[model samples]
Target: MPRKLSRLTLKEQADKALREMISSYRFFPGKWINVERLAKDLGVSRTPVWQAMMDLEKEGLVEHIPKQGIRMAEMTLQMACDLYTVRGLLEGLAGRFAAENISKKTVARLESILKEQQQIVKDQDVVEYSISDFRFHGLIYDFCGNWLLKELLENIKTRSRPFVCDITPIMSGLYQDHVEAVDALKNRDPAKAERVMRRHNLRMRRRIEWTLTREERE
Candidate 1:
C-alpha cells in the first residue's frame, strides 16, 4: 500500500509538472517532447511520466505519437473559429440572462472586478490582469442563474487558458472590450450586452488566429 501510494505521488507530481509546462509553452506547440527527457527533468521514472502524458493527451493539451513520444497540441485557426462560435453562443446567452436576472448588487460586484482589472492593466501586470479578466466573466456567469451554463463556461475556460496566456500582450484592447461589455450590462440592455460580448469574443479569436498563423509561417 505504501508502494502504491508512492507511485500515486509520482504520477501527481508528473501531472502537475506537465500542466505547468503546457501553460508556459515550455513544450511549445508542435514540438515533440521527449518522454525520457521529461522523466529525467522531473526526477521520476518513465511510468509516471507516461501516465501524466496520457492524462494531458486526454485533455487535448498533448498529442501522443506512435513511436516519437509526445508533442504539445497546436491550436489551429479552424479550431479557434469553432471554439469562438460556441463561446459566443454560450456567453451571449449568459450575458442576456444577466441583463434580465442580475441584481444591482451583482452589477456592483462586476464593476469592482472591472476596476481591479483596469488597475492591473495600468500596472502592466499581465498575470493579474488575466486573472481579473476571468473573474469578471465568472461574475457574469454566476449571476446568469444557471449552474449548468456556469460549469460549462468554467470547463471551457480551463481549456482556454493556454490560448489566453498566449494573447496576454493584447490586454489593452481586451480591457476596452471588457469596459464596453460591463457598460452594456449596467444599462440592462440584453441585446447590446450580447452583441458586445459576441464581438469581444470574436475579436479575441481572430487575434489568436493571427498569432498562430504568424508562428506557423515562422
Candidate 2:
C-alpha cells in the first residue's frame, strides 16, 4: 500500500508540475509532447509522466492523437470565439451579482489588489500581474451567488487559455479596465458593472483575434 501511494503521489506531482509548465507557456499551444523527454524534464519515470498526460487529456489541456502521441491543446478561432463569448456573459453576470450584494470589506480588499496590480504593472512583472488580474475577477466570482456559473467560468478559463504574443503591451489597458470595474462596484451600479465587465472581455477577445490573424505574417 505504501508503494502504491508513493506512485500516486508521483503521478499527482507530475500532473501539478505539468500544469505549471502549461501556465508559464513552457508547453505552448499545438506543441508535440515527447513522453520520454517530459519524464526527464520533470525528473520522473515515463510511467508517471504518461499518466499525468492522461489526466491532462481529460481536462482538455492536452490531447492524444492517433499518430502524433500527445499534443498541447491549440486555441482555434472557433474555440476562441465560443470561449470569449461565454466568458463575457459569465463575467458580466458575476459583476452584476457581486454588485447586488458584495460587502464593503470585500470591495476594499479588491481595491487593495488593484493597488498591488498597479505596482506589478509598473515593475513590468507580467506573470505577477496576470496572477493578480485573475484574482481580481475571481473575487467577484466568489460573490456571484451562483456556484454553477462560477465553476463554468473557472473551467473555461483553464481550458481556453488564449495565445498572446506579448503581455507587456496590454498591462496598462487591463489595469484601467479593473479600475472601471471596481468603480462600478463601489457605486453599487449593477448595470454599469455588467456593461463594463462585458466590454472588457470583448476588447480582450478582439485583441486576441488580431494577434491570431497576424501570427502567420510575423
Best by TM-score: 2
Give the TM-score of each candidate.
Answer: 0.72, 0.82
lDDT, candidate 2, 1-218, per-residue tens? 01122444888988777766665556778889888877876666898888888988897789899976999888776677777888999899999988988889999999999999989989999878867877888789888888998888777766655354456777788788899989989999999899988988887787777777777468
Look at candidate 1 and tell me the lDDT of residue 91.
89
Q: Give per-residue CA lDDT, model 1, range 1-218, as digits (tens).
A: 01122444898878877765554435556788888767876667899989988887887877988867688777777877777778888888889888888888888888888889878888898777766777788888898888999888865765666674355667788888788888888898999888878887887888888887887899
User: RMSD per prediction, one decimal?
Assistant: 5.0, 4.1
Q: Which stretches of candidate 1 lie over 4 Å from their true place?
A: 1-56, 66-71, 164-169
lDDT for model 1, please: 0.77
- Candidate 1: C-alpha RMSD after superposition: 5.0
lDDT by candidate, in order shown: 0.77, 0.80
